[model samples]
Target: MRAKDVTGIIGEEIAAEYLSRQGHEILERRWRGARGELDLITRDGAQLVAVEVKTRRGSGYGHPFEAITGPKLARLHRLLLEYCAAVHRLHERRRVDVVAVVLSGTSEAHAAEHLIRGVEHLKDVS
Candidate 1:
């Protein structure tokens, strides 16, 4: 696999581990729907969190969290709803979050950030 793809796999694993450590039960990893993909879907207390994982080798283009735009957030929002409907988990509260992972040249992630409830219904995302 390509280095970037490998990096993503590692990022998702790290993201999942972080979520689990925070007391979230992973409902899905790399979940896909008609709209697009959600990197990590988990139940956080009584809410369903749709997470986007951004991973990069160092801070080349800036931190991973800087990657998610409004359109991407909207896409994830739709996919999250679709996921809830398909799985009959509609009653759960929902939110969007971004998880960033920075893999250093030393073959270890230098940092990871998890932003909770980071998205909202905004028109400026486009």
Candidate 2:
């Protein structure tokens, strides 16, 4: 796979582990619906969470969370609704979340080191 694709996969995996350590039960990863895909689906107590993950090697463009614009969030909300219907959980409490994964190192050559600069989780984003 391309470096970008690999970065995303690694980020999602890291995000999942981080969330799990934080007491969130992961229900799904890379869930695709008619609308689009949700990076992660997790349960935080009684509420269902739909996570959108953004990963980057550096913040030259901007913080990873900045990538999630208003339109992207709207699409995520629609995807969340579709997911609820698919799983027959329309009545359950739900919320949107964002997981920003920033990796250390300036180039792909250092990917072998596999260092994480940070992982930020934003809950109830929508």
Candidate with the greatest TM-score versus the true structure: 2
lDDT of 2 by residue, 13-60 (tens): 999999999999999999999878999999999999999999998888
Off by over 4 Å in 1: 106-126
> lDDT for every model?
0.72, 0.91
- Give per-residue lDDT, candidate 2, residue 22: 96
Instruction: Give me the displacement of residue 116 in model 2, in angstroms.
Output: 0.6
Assess every candidate by TM-score: 0.81, 0.95
In model 1, what lDDT does residue 73 have? 79
Which candidate should be chosen as best, given lDDT against the real structure? 2
For candidate 1, lDDT tens digit of each residue in 1-126? 565676788778877887788798998988878778788888888888887888766666776667787777788888888999999989888888777766656343322332232211211122
Candidate 2 local Cα displacement, residue 57, angstroms: 0.7
